[model samples]
Target chain A: MNNEKKKITMMFILIATLLFGLVPFILLTKRSGELQTGNMLGILVVIIIALLAAVIGVKRIKDLKQGQPVEDELSKKVLNVAGARSFYMSLYWLLAIMLLQPVIADILFDSEMLDAEQALGGGITGMAIIWFLNWLYYQKKGVN
Target chain B: MKNKIKELRARYNLTQEDLAKKTGVRRETIVFLEKGKYNPSLKLAHDVAKVLKTSIEELFLFD
Candidate 1:
C-alpha cells in the first residue's frame, strides 16, 4: 500500500487497540469493590494511550493533507532511536520499581503488594510514554 | 557534515518540496538535510545527488 494508506491503516489499528483496552478497563472498574491503586494506574495508562493515538492521528492527517509522505527515512530513523531509548529506559524503570516495591506497597497499600502483574503493567505504560515523548522530541530536533 | 543541497536545488530551480518529491522523501527530511542536522543513508544521499544532477561528494561536503 501507499504511504498515506499505510499510515491510515496504522492509525485505525491504534484506535481499535485503544478501544479494546477500554473494554477490560470498563469491566474491571465495574467490579463490586473499591478501585485499587493498580486499577487507577491502569485507567491512567488507557488515557495516555488514547491521547497518544489522537496526537499521532492529527499529525498524520495534517501531513497527508499537505501531500507529504508520513513514513520516510528520517521518520524511520527517529522511530528506531526512540524505540531503543525507550527500551533501555524501561529496563531501568522496571529495576527501580522492583527495588522499591516494598516501599511502594507500604505507602500505597499498607501491606505487601507483590503483584507481578501490576509491576509489569506499570513498566509497559512507562515504556509507551517514554517512546512517544522521545519520538516527538527527535522529530522536532532532528535525529543524527 | 554540511551539504550544498540548497544551493544545488536553487541552481535547478527546485523548491524543497519539489526536491523531496523527486527524492521520494518527506519535506521535513529535506529540511533537516539542508540544515545538516540529519545524516542521510547512502541510498538517500545518492538519490538526492542524482536528482540534483551532482555527485554525492559534490552534494554533501564533509568537514
Candidate 2:
C-alpha cells in the first residue's frame, strides 16, 4: 500500500487498540476504586500499541529506504514558519495567563492555580493545533 | 515570482510527474513550483534547471 493508505491503516489500528485498552482500564478502575494490576497492564498495553503505531506511521510516511530526504526546501520553510508562529502564539497566551495568575488565585482562593503539568498540557495542545494547521496549509499550498 | 516550467515542460514533452520523479520530489512540489506559489532553494533550482536542460535564469523569472 501507499503512504496514505498505510497512514490510515495505522491510525485505525491505533484507535482500536486505545479503545480496547480503555474499556479494560475503566472496568478495573470502577470495580476496585484503587490501583490494580489489571489496570496497569491495560495502560501499559495501550502505550505499547500507541508507540508501535507512531513508529510505523512515521517510517511509512518518510519512505526512507536509504536515508533519502523526505522534505524539500519549500516544506522545510513552511514547517519553520509554522513552528515559529505556534511558539509565539502559545508563549503570548502563557504570558497572559502568568500575568493574571495572582488575580486568578485571589478570585479562586487557591494559591496553586496552574501547576507545571497543566502548563505542559497547554503546550501540548498548542503543538497539536500547530501540527493540524500546518498540515492544512501545506495541503492547500501544494495543490496544482 | 513567475516560472516558465509549464511551457518548458510542454516543449520537452514531460509531465509534472515525470519532472517530479527526475528531481526526486513529490508531484505536489512541482505543482507548487509551477504555479509560482513556492520559492525553491538554490540546490532545488539547480536540479530542476538541469532536468529541463535550461538555466535557472531562463526557467524562473524573478520580479
What local distance difference test score does each model get? 0.86, 0.68
Q: Whose lDDT is greatest here?
A: 1
List, residue by residue over A1-144, the lDDT tens digit for candidate 1.
776777678887887888787777677777856577776777777777777887888888888888888789899999999889888888888898889988977887677874765776777788888889888889899899
Give the CA lDDT, 0 to 100, for residue B21 in model 2: 78
Q: Indicate the fraction of true inter-chain contacts that candidate 1 also forms.
A: 0.75
Which candidate gets the maximum TM-score versus the true structure? 1
**Per-residue lDDT of candidate 1, residues B1-63 (tens digit):** 999999999999999999999988999999999999999999999999999999999989888
TM-score of 2: 0.62
Model 1 C-alpha RMSD vs. true structure (Å) is: 2.5
Q: List pairs with backbone clashes in candidate 2.
A: none
Off by over 4 Å in 1: A1-3, A6-10, A13-17, A20-28
Candidate 2 regions off by >4 Å? A1-69, A96-112, A142-144
